[model samples]
Target: MALSVGDATLAALAGVAIRRKPARSGAVHRTGAPVLRDSVEAGTFEEAFFAVPAKGETDRLLHVARKTLDAARRLRRDARLGAKILTTSERVIARLTGSAVRVYEEILTLARLNRGRVFPSYDYLADATGLGRATIGRALAILEAIGFLVRQRRFNRVAGQGPGPRYEQTSNAYRPLLPERVLSYLPRWLRPAPLPEDEVQRYADREADTRYMLKSLSCRELAEATVSGSLGKILAKLGAAVDRREREAQIDPQPLTDSYNKAQTVLA
Candidate 1:
């Protein structure tokens, strides 16, 4: 993720900005002594504080900054997947098409770096994502509708006072919304139950037939094959269509359950 010119300027400003540390407890005590003694004590304190660094504080802050940056980057990546475009509305599994997802991800990356300030222009997005201008526009529209972003009109004074809009991420609520995980699974409400071993074998066979039928078979043949499969096998096949759904359901459900249980305990 290369920083934009605006973002680079902001970063430079933040880097040089000095924040005042709170007054130390012994400042008065040290200053109250003889001037020579105070000077000697100040030098000693400076030597102790700056000369020999506390490895633990330095290491901890570094770790935290690294983690925060990583998390921010991941959130930006996932925000694109959250846009919810380019898939069939039907329950059948389908991969997302086009570079819209990539564009959305880049938008998120820019937003993260700029503290939610994303330039919403099609050209900006297309340039960042290498997507076509039209594709970027479509993706931006979809993203705006999904509540992940908000568009605000601003006057571009540099361009002689015409109104231009900027896109900003409204949902700074970070979660582990990985794009690979999102695209690979169905929603929890639509997910099917796990199949038994016998049903799994039957479903595997049916899946093979489904793939074959997908390659120009007649509608009647495909219908007949679908109908002839056992109910359990059909369900299992559907479940397998989005392999990560079960895992996501499992992973997502427990924390919620635990939270409910804890609340109930408090009430009781």
Candidate 2:
């Protein structure tokens, strides 16, 4: 079976190769036409090397790869991809020194490229990134604690059969979180607005003033108050409407008002 150009592109974008299993590796996986030969003497079926993807599987893989690339590209072009978030995040991250930044950069790369799902072992990352495993651990810890990243430890329940104890350690997935809840983590300049130091006192004072005004003022006066609170705004609208009607009455007296007075006299 020939590999398509789209499949090749997906393989490159995924940073992983999809190749035909070696002739002697183990049991072969079968898709429609038995791409893999079931070996009688081999280990469990799961241990079989994944054979080259069938046409349908390859099509699906390519579709997913294209979609992921499109999503990543769209994210880059987002209108909110402004300097403010980057500036704020950098100011906060500047406190850290050393390999943490390198590890973080690598994690960010993986997360952005894979849509927040990175599944590379420590050794793979170390080799690909040229950073010590211990440094990676420290960086991940700091990022996770600071809410800049989320780490999920995955355990490889099934181990591949090898000469030694099947090394069953799975890589941790690192997801980089966007600049959410920036106020707590960023500096005052980066935040939209800082709460006043006497915020609680100010709230108390406002509450007291609101209660006193509500108790002392008539509905019309309350509505017409200078303060722009929700209650005052509503009342002001009602008062304005009533005042407009009264002024119109003073201009030329309502015919309905005179008619009602005449009716009352007839009733009496």
Candidate 3:
């Protein structure tokens, strides 16, 4: 499936631009650092510590998140707009220093390892990225501000007896997001291909029929009569086809070679 971007208001965009400044020198990269392992220690997170979404949904979101960051890296390489004023989304991309990227990459690695269930604590992130907790926090804030990800705060429920505190904070559940404004930075070939004219018209007709059905049919009638035979079969087949395509997309994802030229040639 193609990536979906979240809507951003103009005011929100302006706020993002005003709040952040680019990082100057990149942080030190630790060489030969010990590989981070999950532990039962205070800082290490357990599976119960998180409230993650379904794997398939998270996987799709993660793919978009990766592409968005890739676009940011590409922009930094091509433009080299150092110290110049930038738009909201551009600034968000520009501010991703080496340290921030490292932190993000480590998070991605962990997410992949856990099969898209990501809820790493600050301690884990810092240890993995070889940066301090403060640096990890800042990087996460920036990533959140850019609409590249979301953090859901989770809390531990109190044990059997009544205690002083009902719930205590645990590791935040992280999910990736894609903001609409940053879509321009994505490579042309990576963008979703437009539907052919016939397919577009078919969908338009289906939408019109749907609207008519909503207006004309009662809820029970619609559920029982309208949803039988050809219409139901078509809907079921459509859903199955989408699921199949998504599975196929997961296998291939992005081809290195640009197929846009070939597509244009065929069209011509």
Candidate 4:
């Protein structure tokens, strides 16, 4: 099939190499070595190709994406779209090709299943969208370039375990975004909500509490103080358990030597 203008734009935005096959060279034949494909391959996108996004940025993006997804879902059900006139969200959806819409809808469905977090693998997306992995990649690139999605590369920490690499690439984390241009067309209810004032205060309070508990008080002082909440009880119990373990260690300072002595006594 011919590549659409939108697909070309998406390819450029994603840095995807969408080109015709290069001509075989006589020098390559003389070398007699296999020519490796440098283009992006399905399921071969590894962690080393991209840096992991910051946790705070991912969190912020995911929050906005969640709101956008919610609004998109609600907009789909609006009766205005069924009529000759289209709602803003409907118009946005209409702009995408039918195949692109299918791929996008499948992604949104998966995100909804994961509580607005897109955690599915490319294979999973292919199975869900009934499209090849390459096609899905192109579709994702399109959505991301249009400011309708944010794709973050993620990795699993192997921690020097029996492995070739310390970290391995995992499925990307996708967050849907509301394009800035489209935001003007959306109604107040359909638009992404601002962060609540209390959320900031609550986060600050939590940080302050953590700092006070961790830095202000020493271990002994914290253990001895009679704190009023469940957190206090948990800490107190943990301290007691640790103390008991230390005392037990002290009681049997040389367990191996003591065991050897007891064995000699029994033999004697």
Candidate 5:
């Protein structure tokens, strides 16, 4: 018998089991059932589960789904484009100085976090990016010199007037540079073949559906449930859109032009 969506969802939530065939080759393989795949499938199925709701809830679900799908589609497009740019930048930096590529990524991560108002201390960044504190400090200095980061000093008059310095991006620094980087640096082998627009649209639709399922819950409840469940990653992805927009607004147009010019020179 075919299971209803609700039934399948509940069973998945309760933890379904699947049998795995043993591998052969004279290897001492441990015989045991794998549960990770079932768990993942269950999570995916749960995101699609929606119980019959009151009159207006169906329309609300559809609206949220549409918005989520739109955001997801744009995200996928941006990510693919961004990856291409970064790959190209990596190759250019690698050729210049083998170590520069990693430093460049560190700068990018810092810039991303800054957009989210998440300024990590030197120690925090050193631990997170696995770069030495001195290296991270040097990279931050370079980023500021290159117009990727701007240091602002604010005085806290209420608290004895001490000077506090914070880093900020010049303005759309990443977005334009990313597209240029993708077009210039992507080695032919590493470039993903162009995906059909229809396939991209399908992914967008699926993302939207998943988002609608989450949106059905109240915001506070959803936050609590997400922390306790497997939906944290999804929530994080959804939240990134806001940060991306803020970063785009602050990106400096001139550096992007310079980065594009530099990329063209490297490609040439």
Candidate 6:
């Protein structure tokens, strides 16, 4: 987390020269504008776009961070980066190994403070992540393949010619590509998040199980419940109506002999 000149390589430590003081953790005082969390009432979200009480500078900066984190979360979830890398998999593998992603984010954390630039050498990455040189190399490769990171080359300096170094090679430069910004390279239409065949079948099975659960739990009274509070009364009335309708039905095929004789005598 701190800078060590002797240990780092020129290519990877490009973003390390700058340092920012941590945000002071204390009670924030309210100032100019009210946040939306403070204003949400029953009526409408459109009218009252109030925000949470940002008491001080700390809270305000935190508010900004929360917004950024939320945006990053959305971009991460909806992105089909795994599928993009493994073309044969074609399905969105939302949950992949985080080793590479973690490294990518560590670079982003530095880049965010450094104004969208990160050039950590593999050594710095290894030191920060506690991973081996080869592992870090693989992680960086994966990140580049998935379009979450990019790099630039800086001209190596010759000691005699211009700068302090004796002989210089091109040092690596890096940029962390955010999810939302990735659309520039990987279009939305091209990045379709599909489910694998097995996953799709499992989801279908789950749906069927849920439907059965609902059917087993369902009742005629509940179905007949038209209003909210008076369900019992409604059910009682429905039961009575059903009984009466059954009594009114005349299903007999023939009249009794006594009734027939009475009818004949009355006609006579």
The best candidate in terms of TM-score: 3
- Compared to the true structure, candidate 6 yields what TM-score? 0.32
TM of each candidate vs. truth: 0.25, 0.31, 0.44, 0.35, 0.25, 0.32
In candidate 6, position 23 carries an lDDT of 21
lDDT of 1 by residue, 146-260 (tens): 3324443222112223345222112121111122223223344323346899999999999898787666543443444444324435555664554557567877776878999
Q: Of the pair 4 and 6, which is ahead by lDDT? A: 4
Best by the lDDT measure: 3
Q: By lDDT, highest first, what's the ranking? A: 3, 4, 2, 6, 5, 1
Name the runs in model 3 displaced over 4 angstroms: 1-85, 160-165, 194-268
Give the per-residue lDDT digits (tens) of candidate 5, residues 12-95: 987863323432333322333222221222222222231223444333322332333343344456556775333433432222
How far in Å is the alpha carbon of 193 misplaced in model 5? 2.2
| Deviating ranges (above 4 Å) for candidate 4 | 1-95, 158-165, 185-268
By TM-score, the better pick of 1 and 5 is 1
What Cα-based lDDT does every candidate model obtain?
0.43, 0.52, 0.61, 0.59, 0.43, 0.49
Each candidate's clash count: 0, 3, 0, 0, 9, 16
Candidate 4 lDDT: 0.59
Model 5 lDDT vs. the true structure?
0.43
Error of 3 at 168 (Å): 1.0
Superposed model 1: Cα runs more than 4 Å off: 1-98, 157-268
Model 1 alpha-carbon miss at residue 196, Å? 37
Candidate 3, residues 37-96, lDDT tens digits: the string is: 221222334344444445554454455556766766766765675535466667677665
TM-score of 5: 0.25
Stretches of candidate 2 off by over 4 Å are 1-95, 159-167, 179-268
